[model samples]
Every structure is written in C-alpha cells, then in structure tokens.
Target: MILVSGCTGSLGDTRTNDSTDDPTTGNPTTGNPTTVDPRACEDGTVRPGRAPLRRLTRFEYNNTVRDLFGDTTDPAFSLPSEDVGNGFGNDADTLSVSSLLAEQLSTVAEGVAQRATATPDALARLAPCASNVSPEGEEACARTIVERIAPLAYRRPLAAGEADELLALYSVGRTDASFDVGIATVIEALLQSPDFLYRVEWGTSDPEHPELRRPTGDEMATRLSYLFWGTTPDEELRMAAQAGELSTKEGVRAQAERMLEDPRARKTIRFFFDNLLPISNLADLERNAEAFPTFSRQIGALMREETQRFLEHEIFEGTGTWASVLTAPYSFMNGPLAAFYGVSGVTGDEFQQVQLDTTQRLGLLTQAGLMAGTTHSNNTNPVVRGSFVLQKLMCQKIPLPMGDILERVKPPDPYSGATARERYSQHSQDEVCRTCHQYLDPVGFTFENYDAVGLFRTTENDVTIDASGSLPGTPGTVSNATELVQKLAESEEVHDCFATRWAEYGYGLTLRGEDTCTKQAITTAFKASGYNVKQLLIELTQTDAFHYISVASQE
Candidate 1:
C-alpha cells in the first residue's frame, strides 16, 4: 500500500541466466537485418504512438502550492503511495486513483483552497471583476480565476460553458454563505474535479486524415506542463494556448524558454532529482547507532545540505554537465559532515565547500547519501548499487528475480571472516543464483573500501576492499573507480537514459516502443543546444506527441 516511487536505485536482479542471440525477424536464415516498411505511414492503417493522461505528480503538487499561494505544505507526503514505472513516480500508467487517495485529495483540496481564498496574496492573484452581481459578477470572477489558477491547474482556459458551471457553483456557495466562502468553495470543486486531478487527453479522428488524429492546443498545455513543469499550467501557458501559438512548433519553443526563466521551473527539476535519487536523509537519514555512534542527528542534516550546496555550485552556479557532477572536487560540510568526510578545516555549525583529494573520494560512486540509501540496516548492497548505475544512468533494464530463487537465501556466518562480497559471491556458484548475482556482485566489489554509508575503510573482515570492476558493455577491460566514472559519464546510453527519463516525465508516461521518435528528437535537440535543460523543456512542449490523444477501444 505504501508504494515508494522515486528511489534512485535499480530494481534489477538476475534470474535464469539467459542471453539468446537478438531474435532475427526478416529472413531467419539469410542473416540480413529486418527492415521496416517505409511507405507504411502513407497506407491507411493505425500507427503506434505514445499517449498519456496528464496529472499532478506528488512533487509537482508541492511546488505548485509554493508558487500559487506561497504554501510548501507537502500533500504528497501522505497522498496514497505512487507506483514507480521506468524508475520514476511520473509514470502515468503506474499512477492510480483509489478511494484512499481520493479522500486524501479531498482533504488537501479543501485545505489549499481555503488558504488560497483567505490569503491577501491569493485575492491579489484574482483579476478585478467589472461588477459583483449574479451572472455578470460570476462571469468576471470565474474568468479571472480561470485566467489565473486554471493555467496552473487545467493548463487551459475553461470553455464558456465550463466557466458558467464554475460560476453556478459560486452562486450556490454565495447563497448559502459569504461571497468569499462561496468563491472558495467553487475553487475547492475545481481542485477536486477529475479534470483537474487527471490530465485527460485523447485522439480526435481527423475527417481528412483518418490515419492521423492529435491532441488539441488545450490538451497540449496540460501535456507541456506535466511533462516539463511536473505541475499545472500557469497564466502565461494558458494565454499562449488562447493565442493559438502553443499549437504550433514555434510557439512551443518560445513558451518553453519563457517557462525556464520562471522560478517555478527549478522546483520541477529539483523534485524530479529527489524522486530519481530518493535520498531520504536529505531531510533525515536513519543511521546505525552502534557502529557509528559518533553520528548524530545534526550530521544527517549537514550531509544533505552539503550535497545540495555542491549541486547548486556546480549545476546552476557553474556548469551543469554529466562530467562536472561526478568529478567536481568540492562538497559542503559543517562540523559533523566535515568530520565524517575526514576533513579538518571546517568549523562547528558552519557549512562551507571543501575540495578533496581523489584518493580520498570519487564522484557519486562514493557519495555517502547514495551509499546509505542502498545499504541495509547492517550492510551495503553492491547488487543494489550496481543495479542503480545500470538502470538510472545506463537506462538498461534488469529483470526481477523470480520468487522461487529468493527462498533459498542464505546469510554468511555473523562471526565469520567473510565479507559481504565474499558472502555474495557464493550465489554465483549456485546454478539458479549465479546468472544474476554475477552481474551485481562484481560491480559492488569495486566499492569494497567504502562501508555501507560510503565512509572509506581499509578492510572488510580480513580482506582488503578492492574498488575495481569492469562494466558489462564497455570496451576493453578496465579497472578502478576513475575508469568507471569516465565510462559512465561520457556514455551515449547515459545521455539517452536521461533523455528517456525526462521525456517520460514530460509526457507523464513510460517512454516505450511508441515514444522512440519523441525520445530521439529530444536527445538530438538537447545535444545541438549544448545540453541546456531549458532548451529541452521547449522541445517537449512543441513536439507532435504533446498535442495528441488516443481514442478508446470498444470492449
């Protein structure tokens, strides 16, 4: 029931070690690659493509509150747990609306709506009504609310009838209560409405081109907001839709650029990174007290603060690139985290950046936050850590192990000299276990020198922790952390993985077989534009997929 969506680790485990040659489809015996028909598009046939119902992600909900009413209350903190697809919470297919979540949403909607209506800031957001009366006052008030909140909520202006319905809701509330309470009640309804919660988009059968139907400009606004901003559309985006520019390629690009400059865009990126990494200790990391008794609650706060500072310095303050993320020698630390990282100059109660010698540490490969999340209550999981790199960075999938394979689980002797790796290596010999364990353990062995939380250590048991291992699909057999970082940082697969993750997030679904084209375009555009995050945002908003909806199949 408590589905955790945004943990930055791999869920891959090996089962039934099997690698068959890529299946040949064209001429089974000719050895020629299968070729797809080129003219199929012109033929009258249904084509495969991506479709999604846009909605607010948990992170997007939190950020939107801050922007709309300066409220950072985290509704998603306890909103019904979300399922992760393709290693993210933004996957629309994995998202579900249940009675539990519905009830929670109702409560949140009530709280947020009341807060927005009462705050002077919220009233300031509303446009001045020409006059406060029955239909006329209602029309102006509804339009103003539509113009302001709808952009961030529904991502488009409500149709005149939809506006009238909203006005009617206002009327009921006004008749029963004060005008302010009535209007707030109407806002509550919009917040709770399915239209607001689930971003519904679909295909319209084109009369002239029956083979091609697409999402309208209004639908595209939701598509763009959820994908890039991870939240509702703002006034600017809704206005763009009204002007009909958002429907065109040029308009999409312009709006994306404008949105990047808006402060809220940063929140979108931060929330995603949080979900992708799931470093819980950024708020409060649970640590083993008996082993590292020196570790205090305050150190947990400092640890995450230092990392955030490092990201700010490198990404926004300096250059945001795959390389800089791993190799930047500086990190933040106060008295406690500084002591943990083994630095001496940092004073008590103050966080400042410090450069480390490479011998002491590497990139995220040896970071405490990442290490802590992957470790157990007692030990580090190399298999889990190895899987994280493969799935999160490389974008390769690891299959889940069958239930039968796990029941045979055996733990090494508690007092034995065997290290976690030596114990893990035993699985490689088991005919059933070896196939998958082989992939995870070797990668884990490379981090042997670091304990569960990434603190450097000389040995595990009696064996020296050897931090060297080869990657599965890399050229030449290389060893050591430096080579691993180099291979991962510059990989096309890594960049492609990032592209896939972002596009899936932007479109609010898993980037799968149908999304090949959108993914490629986003990757290409991002590269051509110097890997600017903002430019990629623009590309997603303008793409054909952003404006298309699917027709329901008959049962």
Candidate 2:
C-alpha cells in the first residue's frame, strides 16, 4: 500500500464561524461581554483548529530509531530530506510521502530492522524471552516480542487485531528461518506500519460540542513527547497516559514542565531557533578567504554552535525572556571564536559564557554568525540584512521584486572607496528600487559598524561608516545595531510574532484568520509571563489548540 493510505481519515477543516470574539478586545463583535478574562473567546467556547496527520520528519525518524532500537547509525539519512515548508520541516501540510520516499522508507526500515536483530544478544534485548525459548515455545516467544515492540512502535497500546496482524507476519518469516529472522520481519513491518510512522489522532467525543473533539490521553502524550523531545513517548509518559493523568490541563502542564528540564528539550529549542534564524545556513557560508584569512567553514560551524549554546542557556538557565534573547550582552564562545571576535581569556575549544563589548556588540542580531550570513562574501549587503530584520524579526511580508527589476539592479560595489552605507546609497537613487529599498536599506544600514565577517569596524576604505537607521514603528533612529535590537526587544509586534512562531511550530500548521483566538490566548499569556521563553512553551500546551481537534467536514 502507498503511504497515502496512512492519512485516509486524519484530514480536517478548521471551524471558521465558531467564535465572533475580537482578538484585541476579547468582546463579541455584536454581543455583550461574556466573561472578564480577556484571553477567552467571545462566546467562551473552545474552538480548536484542524491538525492533519503528521509523518515523522527525518530528524524525528532518526531519533525514534535511536530510542527504539538503541541503534545510533542514523539510518533515516538514507531517506529523502524533508521539504522545509513554513520554515520548519515538520509542517503537516508538506509531509506527504511520494512513491520515492515510500520506497526509501521501506529500504531504511529493512536496514534498521536487520541491524537491530543482528545477533542473539540483540534479540534477547529486543524480547527477553527470546534468549531461552524452545521450539514448542517459538510462537509464544514471537508473540511476546510482538507484544513488547508493537506498542512502542505504534506509540500506544495496539488495537484488538493489531498484535494478530504483526504475529501473522512473524509466523510467515519463521516458517523455515530462525527466530531472529522472524523478529526481524516483525521489526520491518512495525517500522513501516501506518500507526508507527504517522501520529494518528482520533479525538474522543465532546458532549458539550458535538462538532469538536478532544485528543485522547494517549494521543496527548504522543503530542507532548514529539513537541518537547522530538521522539516517541518514553515509558513514563506512556504510563501516565494509561493512568489517565494526561486527561487534564494541569497534568499536561506538569509533564511539560518536567520535560523541558531534560537535555532533549535543549535540542528542540536549538531546532526552533536554528530554523527561525539563518544560523544553520552558516555551514555553507561563502567568504573570500583572501580578504578573510582567519575565517573558514570550521569557524562557521562554531558560530552556529555559539548561537545554539546561547539560546539554550538563556531559555533554561538565564532570564528566559525575549528581552534577553534580543539584548543580552554576553555570548558563549571558545578560544578560537573569542580570538576571532578580538576577545581574550577564554581558552581551549570548550565554549564558555563570555561578556561582549557592549559598545559594539549586543545579542543575536549583532552576532558574527548572523551578520556574516546576511552579508556578501567580501562586503556587507544592507538590503539583505534589512530584509531579514523586516521579514523574519518583524513578520512583515516583503513582496517579491519583479524579475526584470532584479535583472536590472545589482548589489553595491564592494571594490569602491566609499563605505558600505555610501555604496548602498544607489538603492535609493532608483525610484523603482527605492520603493522597497527605502524600507530595507534603512534597517540594514544600522549594521554598517559590522563588516563582511562581522568584525567591528569604524572605517571601510578609509571612510567613517554611518550606522544609524530607523525602525518601522519606533520613533526617530537608532545609532547602531545595538540600539536597533534594543528597540526590537521591547516591541509588542515583535513579541507577538515570537508567540505566533512558537504556536505554529508546536501545532504543525500555519496560522490563519480562524486562529485569531488561539493566537490571542497564546500572545496574552506570553505577555503576562513577560515573554519567558520556557514559560511560553508551557503556555502553548495549555491552549485550546493543543487539547482539542476540529475534524474534517463530511462532504
């Protein structure tokens, strides 16, 4: 069967007219207020949106095999890389498997299963009863193995006939082969099973709203594990689901709080920030080695690591606020990075938190990695930098420039004597280019203090750089990148945008008009929590969007 059959019943449509609540005021557009809490919908009804069936991304699949089989080969690397829709590979809409991907999945599963059951010791670990089973007890031992691994592979207790189906596969393989071969067959089948690959959520009936349904406790456990740990639910979480502890919001919150303290949560945090920013792109960052003699691909990799370390520390160990993320005056750096940034005292390759030069550096925007990633190989590009700030940081949609316009205009000349700001002044010279460049170049010019490799500079080609620029909503202008980021750290729009991004990443869907109330609830709590990064994650689990599902209409 094709992978398309895996998603047969998981399709869904969002409820558009479920609530008339004003997102800002929390009052009905045509009726009186229903409650005092501003975070609720106007009718005080929980209207959840739809969540499609999500197949495991390559990252999740690798993690699953590592956890499930204790195999560290990263077999999913053989599978196709995922489409990075909506800035994340996990977006459910783009996770459909093509025939090629299906074939790869089967191939990878066979390899993983063969490796997992390669020896008698491994088979014993897979099913403890396998080590000493007699010929008479072979079927019984196979049943034992099926009962043990199927629940984990499916991520929930098997349905009535599920174990029988898996045992049937085991029987066919064991007809002439040994028990290990039979177990291998079962492993391969489990890996390719729809229930194993897809997070299939069939919501329970909600009497208060017949149209709406809440995810079952086991399904909730699956959701939490995947979001927080990026893998299958552990035995403890599964036990909690079986015990009905995951049926309540408080229980889920308790579990999320516990999960965030794990090292696995750090990886999830890194994935989110790595995708949200341009950090991961640094691996292939092209630079003119003749000009930047000290820079190399290794340095780019370290820069990516530096940002990830800072993000993990700030969210879990530091102030854990959006303010800190944008304006923290310290960053983690090893000896090489410290020397690269002209700082001293840090030694060895072990990264440690080091204070930054406040006069020149501040937080993520001024970091060398991002600064270098956004600029050109030999010179700074204000337009690209400004577009990154506008489109990514502020969530402003900068429409694509016409193809003819792109062909006619070129980047500022790096070989010129003028500073980056002066060279880029040509963008505003053309009326057609000025339309978008006016918005882009200004924000980008603020980073003129940092050069191509993000080195602090006062002059380029013997000309004093002008690093002053204006933010869109903020008044007046900021003198440099530090001031620009400081203003952004306090912006309501930026804060709400951060919340919107997390909600989208966690729920695996892009936000739409119907998601207003859900977004408002998350934003309100985020603001209430002073934008605490960890607390914002906890708030995400408590939203209606996380707890309920709106099934597809019967057309």
Candidate 3:
C-alpha cells in the first residue's frame, strides 16, 4: 500500500527528436508525415511536446491552499524556497523535492489538516459526519468524507485503491481516537500525496492522431486554472471538466474569457508581470543611506506597488496593448514615488494615476522599480540595465562574463573626470570584453538620465549626461530613455520576443527547437490582436500547444 510519489528523472533527462518533418503531411492512417509536401505541414498541425511533472511553487502553494480551504495562514512560507527557471518560478523542470522538503510537507500537512477540522462548521463543511453517531455510523461517515473531498484535493478522481487506503487510515484514527480524528488523519494523508503536491498531467492517446495525445479534461482544467487564476479549479471550472466542456477549443476559450473577467484574473496578470519585470525583488533592494539619503524599505515597497497598479490599470481598464504599455504617458504614483519622480499634486499615501512629462518618463522601461533594481547601491550600472533590456525584453541569451574579465572591466570613478557613459566605454576598448559588451552597453547607455535610485538627473559630477545610444538592427537612434522605449514599442522583434516570453511563462516550459511552429503561431495571433496583453492570454489557451501532448512510443 505504499503510494509512490511520482519522482521522475532529472530536468534534462527527457529526449525529444528535432525532426524538421511536419506531422500534418503524414498519412492520417499512419502516424508519419510526408517529406515531399512542405506546404502540407504549414496548416499548423504540429503535435505539442510533453511537459514534465510540475511541483507547485511556494506562491502557487499558498494561493492554492487559501483558495482550497479558506485558510490564510500561508504555511508554505516554511517550505524551502523555489528556484527560478526560464525567468519564472513555476517552471516544471526545475521544481523538485528532497528529503528535507518531504519532511516539511508532512509537518505542514498535519497543521493544515488540524486547522481545517478545528470547528464543527469547518468539520461539517469538509467531512459532514454526525458527532454523536454509533460506531458503525461513524465508519460510514468517515468513508463518505474520504469519497467526497479526495477528488478536489488531488485535482482528479481517485484511482481504484486510493479511496480504500484513505478509509483504512480513517479506521485507525476512529479506533484510536474520535470520528473527527479519523477524518483529520485522512486529510493529512491526502495533503501529502503526490497527486496533491504535484500537477500530474498524463494525456490520453488521441484516436485520430495516434502519435499525439491530448490532455484529459481534468488536466486541461487544472492547466487553465493555474495559468489564469493561480489556484485550483473553482466549482464552475470543475463542473466544466466533469461535463467535458474543457475538451474543445471553444470550451477552453469560454472558460478563459470568463476567468479573465473575474477579479482573480487581475491577480494572475500581476503575478505574470511581477515575474517578468521582477519588481517584487525591490523589497530586498539595498542602498547606501549616505549615497541615497531618502531611500527606505517603505519606498522600495511603494515602488513595487506602483508598477503593479500601472500594469493592471492599462491591461484591464484601458486598451491593453503593448504599445500603450511601452509608450503610455502616465503612471501611478504615491507621495513618496511622486517625490522620487519629481512630480507634484499627488499628496496622499494612496497611488493615483498621474500624467507623465513626456520629456522624462515614457513606459515600464523607465519606471523607478526597474531602474533601481538593475542598478548598483551607489551608482547606476549601465551594463546591468542594458543586459536586462536585451535579455528580458528582447529574449536574447547573453553569456556571463568568465573569470577576471568582469574584474578588469570596471567603471571609471566620477572624480576621474568621466561620465557614466564614458566609464563604460572602457569595455568596448578591450577586445575580450567588447565581444559581449558591444551588444549590452549601448542599449544600457540609453538609460543614463535615470540615476541608480532612478531619479532623473541632468548631470553627474557636473558633467552633462549623455543618454544617446542605438540598438543594433533597430531602425533609429535613441537620444534618451523616452525615445528608446518608443523605438522598442514599434519594433517587430520586441513584440515577438514578448510573445515568446509569455508562451514560456504560460506553458511552464522553455521554448525548445521542436516548439518553433507553435511559438510562431502564438506570435502571429498575438500580432493580429494588436499586441493586446489580455487578448494574447486568451489566444494562448486556444493553441494546440495548450491542448495536445506528445506521446512516447512505449507509453
């Protein structure tokens, strides 16, 4: 009766063939695509690659428990921290369990189970058994409780032996203690099960395409809920799965649309941007008090909230376009941030939408949070700022500097009669450093107007700042941060890169070579939707990548 937790191999253990042959051109009767007709595969019939088993991240765990049991204790805070993969904490491949984590899970499960059954109302909602019933009736009530709650906890129907095992646990508890004790024991066991801790998605074989497998309705429902709502499926979503509504593209779209309109959608959207822009890390940003006399943790927190509020207002309340996100002339600011941005009339602690002076601020790229996070404690680091733009915004994979190259290529001192721009120019001089800095430094130099703390400045060390720079392959030169954001707003590469990033985040897997067709389709649809962020999310749920899974031959 040992329930084996589904511990698969390492992240890179799975091997996928990088065949260029399209699956659509193959014979329908046979699972082989033809090599002759290149156009036959262009109809977008590629099978989706398989996603590894995903463990819920700390944030996902907390949100899930809060939604699942109306518990707000945030027990996952005691769990080990999660590693970031593909720029997101939810990557399926990187999330793994260790012996320490297993012990932590067991301990947390006991506390959560006890809390869930703390009162008669709570016990009734969860187990619905009579307190003063006879022993036989108590056993019957325990069985009923196990049968009712296990599916929601596991996110799927129990297997043949699962219910009996839980009932057995309940029997031990009833004999040893009380009926409530029996139910709590079952609850504790279910919480620690692999089915609860991991998103165990295994697709059923597609009869029409034998080589391809489609996720079960329950699996798709779980995918949609976690992706859009950041929690387990609600009653309507669970009903949709049971009724087979999640099996069709139209069904998935309807649910996605409905969920997107709900208030939870705003939380999900904010979570995505929080990972994308990574403003959440600002809470831990350190600064020198002498260098930044006014900086404080309170200001750091306010900066994060400002960015989140601005994103939500634009995507949900306004037009929701990428252009508006990058070139919008307004932002949300509070008293502290307003002072930092050099804006007036915003006097309260609450964040209010204020129009920006086009000369200084433009879009998210110029936000104080991003500028401050990508800088050093005392002075601005153009290399860090530039790398953030190229790697995060454009999806370029920049290699890290090896050995002493970083130590050697240092910024010039302000007292040495050099501007920040002039200091970073030293990287371009050394042939070893120029290989990478040639691509990074130029783009970072465009943000010179914003200091390390993200305050707008005209000069450093009495030298007029030079914020002019150019992005390679872009049409025009950017004289300042405003122009840089505008130029990025109009670039097709930037749009597609953003699309690629969202795909990775939404799918919970890195975009591989085999995912080229699906990635391109998402990018195409994203472009057609006028780069609307909300529309792009709905469109992602409708793609084959979201519905179908590739089946291994042995399976």
Best by lDDT: 2
List RMSD in Å for every model shown.
Answer: 5.9, 7.3, 7.5
lDDT per residue (tens digit) for residues 218-267 in model 2? 89999999999889999889989999898889999999999989899888
Native-vs-model 3 lDDT? 0.77
In candidate 3, what are the lDDT values of residues 128-203, reduced to their tens digit?
Answer: 5744456768778777778888998888988899889999998887685877777889888988888989888787
**TM-score of candidate 2 against the unseen true structure:** 0.90
User: TM-scores across all candidates?
Assistant: 0.82, 0.90, 0.89
User: Which residue window of length 10 is worst by lDDT in model 1?
Assistant: 14-23
lDDT comparing candidate 1 with the true structure: 0.61
**Candidate 1 structure, TM-score to reference:** 0.82
Alpha carbon lDDT of each predicted model: 0.61, 0.80, 0.77
Error of 2 at 204 (Å): 0.5
For candidate 3, what is the TM-score? Answer: 0.89
TM-score-better candidate, 1 vs 2: 2
What is the alpha-carbon lDDT for the whole of candidate 2? Answer: 0.80
